[model samples]
Target: MQMLDGDVVLILGGGSGLGLGVARHFISEGASVAIFEVSQTKLDALKAELGPDVLLFKGDVTSVDDLTACRQAIVDRWGRLTSLVGSQGIFDGQVPLRDVPVERVSSLFDELFHVNVLGYLLACRVFLDLLEASDGSVVLTSSVAAYAADGGGLMYTASKGAVLSAVRQLAIEFAPRVRVNGVAPGAIADSQLQGPKALGLDGVKQSDIPKEAMQEGFKRLALMPTLPTPLDYAPVYAFLASRHNKVVTGQTVLLEQGSLNRHMLSSAGVSGGIGTPLG
Candidate 1:
């Protein structure tokens, strides 16, 4: 239906993983897409895959100057931006607080928060005026970790929780002009999600985890029989970024396939009664 037709959308970390999925969805819906990514390799890859129609900007999400330059470039090309998507983040490899060395904790926290939380804040700040002018929306990539434990370790969980809070507060603060929302997806099987350099997991990707372990993890945590692919969750971002979503603001949609329902059932019997009616 081309819900985002004639819109100019800016996405942070849009070169790969969930961000790339969202960018593809936006483009399919007829929006002009701009991506800000730190990896030149990913940028080149996306340019090749998505074709020259998509604007690819090489920049670190944590850097204000980089974000500003990207925003400026978008303005110069597209004249105005209609939506901002913050999808940049780092995972913590589910390392428990006790397992982390005390000496590395400080650096680990800073590195994770800078990319996951502060990066979103900086993107919103840099694009505030443009968003307000366009009466646009902001969609931040949160996670199941934001609301529950075991989705990640202390560092990742806390950072995403902060993202949830920021979505609400920013929605209120930008009310009647710009809308703010978030999507909290769980256990995406194909994500290029990585961990903090401080914890020596900078090169880790979700696909690197053993298939059986990943499947078992999702089975234990989610009521759904299988985990979702990154593409499965992209539509939510596109909907939130659309101008037709006029009344939804300050809400983070949970895309975890009923993972929260796991708390009510025993792990051994989880999903056994999925199709049964509640009596």
Candidate 2:
């Protein structure tokens, strides 16, 4: 459809996982992308895979100076930005509030909020003018946790909640100039946010689950009964970013195959709550 042709997008955390998946999809659909991320190795990999068409910027979303530089670089390259996708976050070492030490709670919350919420705001702040120039859209990568209680600990949950609110508020504030929206992904495989032990188990262990258990668990949560990949979630972001979805601002699109609507997760009649989606 050439819906996004001639547009330029800035994707924070575009080095891997869902962000990388969306980046590839955007390039395929004929849009330029500026990837703002911290991982040099991932950036190098993306450069190898995508070549000169992709712009690579090494910046931490939590750093205002870095984010500002990224915005300026984008403007210098494309003159304006048509889309902004904030996909930066972490799932490391977040435990329940009750189990957390009082002294450590503040720092934990600070780190998560700094990266997930503040980082997004800073990026939007620096690039609002550029986005507005093109009447662009911003799509934040929120989680099912934002709407439900089953995802992360207090901090991560709170961070996601704030992310959800940010999308709505940005949409309202930016108005007709720039559309703001979000996508809440569910139960994606090969996610990067594993807990402190390298496997990073908030609840489910990716490597421990057998293939049969994996499929059944997905069936129990997703009404559509299909295993979805990071790539599966790309189309929604593309739609939200494209001119096709002109009126979709302030909405959080669900990409969980209907898992968010189910009341109970009964994999073999087990009474465990629905498993949280990773990545």
Candidate 3:
């Protein structure tokens, strides 16, 4: 049997990037898939392309009402949800704290934290009962930023650090019933990760950069030689969200290509950092 056969999984913010990749990978692994995406464009396209086989829901991850309603819909259709993978996040424009106008700091903090941190908490709360019943899993996305500097700006790093902590706390609180874990990835190829509206960078995306520049820059720092795509990171998310993950909870698996492991810095002194999105 397939590893995920019979599992009912939800990929929150699955419209694009790592979430989309996980949703598609889970399906191939034989699990039934449902995705919650805020983008209307993604919802329409996914529904048409993935067909009746994959359930698609439209909702913002930070909205309690949206998540609650989606929860009910999942129960109504599949009767149970075995896993939830939180894959929604926004970048902080990699702005230095001093460079950010003092006024924008509060708005920037709220914007990034609400989506990157609170969204995952709300999803876990909304779906706790179902997950407990099934002895399922909760996998949240963190970034290499949480551990090392230069992975993102101050706000983005703080938000991801909160997510990493939440994984540990939720694992303990949820107890033996539901497993909670996290994945901290390095620069993802083809990432659609965008910047915060508070900084007026919502229109900016990592994909807006030249792909060759992004890849080569990332390759220079990464020990793994090549940058990884969303699909390249999906299998780890899949295993964490599956029944096979019995012994792994409360810990975050760092798949950062050993980029940050270098003790020796270039003459540039970490100035050669890549600005691409880290999952």
Candidate 4:
């Protein structure tokens, strides 16, 4: 049987991008999946694509009522939830802190935090009981930005860092019952992630970067030399969400494809690994 067999998962932001990809993979692994998405368009499209197998709900993750209603729906249908995969987030357009107008700082921070950070928190909160009851898990999406610099601009980095921290704390709180962990992916290929509305960049997508150009950039700097698709990441999330993940909790797995494995000066081929075979 597949690892996720007999599991029931609720994916926040599962209408498109990474969430959507994970939902599909989970289903193929024999798990029943439901997705909470804010986009009616994505949800409608999913109804046609995912058919009757996956439950689709339209709601913002930042709102308690929205999440509570979705939690009820999951309970009504699946009877229990095995895991919650948080894949909802927005980028900050990589705008430097100094460049951002002082007047918009508060708005920008609130908007980013509300979705990227609070959304994850609210989902975990609303589903806490189900997860505990089922001995389930929580797998969240963080980013390499949380550990190192330049993964995103100031606001985005801070938000993802917050996610990393939450995974640690929530894991402790939910210990011996539900596992809480996270994945910090880098340069997701074909990602549809957009920018923050407060920065007037909500329409801007990371895919706007030319695919070949982006791939080339990753190849040059990353040890893996290949940008990872959501599919590439599905197994990690699957394993962590599954009951098989007994030893891990309160940990955010750094999934940067060995890009950060080298010293800071190594990306330019300045030579940092092994150090000439250590003399």
Q: Which numbered prediction scores highest in lDDT against the true structure?
A: 3
Best by TM-score: 4
TM-score for candidate 4, please give it: 0.94
Structure candidate 3, residue pairs in collision: none
* TM-score for predicted model 1 compared with the true structure: 0.93
Q: lDDT tens string, model 2, 13-83?
A: 98887788888888888899889988898888888888987889998998889988887888788778888
TM-scores for all candidates: the values are: 0.93, 0.87, 0.93, 0.94
When 2 and 3 are scored with lDDT, the better candidate is: 3
Error of 1 at 92 (Å): 1.3
Point out where model 3 deviates above 4 Å: 263-279
lDDT of model 3 at position 183: 98
The CA root-mean-square deviation of candidate 2, after full C-alpha superposition on the true structure, stands at 6.8
Q: What is the C-alpha RMSD of each candidate to the true structure, in Å?
A: 3.4, 6.8, 6.6, 2.4
The backbone clash count of each candidate, in order, is 0, 4, 0, 0
Off by over 4 Å in 1: 263-279
Cα-based lDDT for every prediction: 0.89, 0.80, 0.92, 0.90
Candidate 1 lDDT over 1-279, as tens digits, reads 688999999999988888988888889999999999999999987877888788899998888999889988998898899999998888888899999999999999999999999999999999999999999999998998888877789999999999999999999999989999999998887778887899898889766888788888777667785867777888889889999997899999998888787675555557656786888
Better of 1 and 2 by TM-score: 1
Q: C-alpha displacement of 44 in model 2, angstroms?
A: 1.5
